[model samples]
Target: MSRRSRPVVSNRVRRFFASFIFDKPAAAPASVIARHRLLNAGAYDEGSGTINGVMLIAVAAILISAVALGGNFLVCVSDARSAADQAAIAGAESARDGDFDPCIKSRLATTLNKAALVICKVDEEDVTVKVAVKTAVPFAPLVSRMARAGPVECS
Candidate 1:
């Protein structure tokens, strides 16, 4: 006796044809069923809500901390620039007035602005100043800025 070979049809194809014939589909794989159950394990549990709330609060706190640090950095940069400009103007004015040392006034101005004067140069009526602002934030670098002031002659 000889047996005839029959073509094999995939589960997806069988399911599609079964649906058209109003027949039941095949059962899903064990792994898929297990994953679905695991995903919904804590769906109706009261502890899940608390866990989710705690995660949200942690995320919000981190974001707020980052924004505060960023704002502080910007303030530090602005302070450095302002200090440099004030020091340069002070030095230039002192130079024009024939003060014994223009850099002395520049250093005083920076100190008053809560910054340190890194460099101060006076040439005739022109003055250049560099100031640094140090922040209390850990790991933050010192902010520095430079400015120049002089008498401008226009014809």
Candidate 2:
């Protein structure tokens, strides 16, 4: 019996030639090629240093704003409490004279000078005094209004 023999090409040899010498289309997909090119492109490259710098600046700005807001709130509350105390004292002193308008005006003036809005009134029949304090926080072109401890003394 006679046997026929076929020509053999090693897989590695074929692959090497096919990759380097063949005129066939690239095996890599278009999307993959585009992605590789984009990754290596200098214009699209963003170094870690630039990104970190921007993040640091953003964090600093946020921290500073938080501190400023807290400080402003503290000042507003302190001024409001002082004004309320003054109003109470004046109201008590004026109660004997049956004239509360002077005391109310004095309290309002004190708060207004300290960037606080105040409304003070005394009920003659009930002998109760009420004080309202409003303060504005500074934010450019935006009104940040807050009211603090309204009607400090109802009775």
Best by TM-score: 1
Worst 10 residues of 1 by lDDT: 1-10
TM-score of every candidate relative to the true structure? 0.69, 0.47
Best by lDDT: 1
Return the clash pairs for model 2, or none: none
Off by over 4 Å in 2: 1-46, 100-119, 123-155
Please give the lDDT score at residue 73 for candidate 1. Answer: 87
Off by over 4 Å in 1: 1-44
Q: Model 2, residue 100: displacement in angstroms?
A: 6.1
How many clashes does each candidate structure show, in the order listed?
0, 0
lDDT tens string, model 1, 42-76? 54465878899999999999999888888888999
User: What RMSD value applies to candidate 2?
Assistant: 11.7
In candidate 1 the C-alpha lDDT for residue 132 amounts to 94
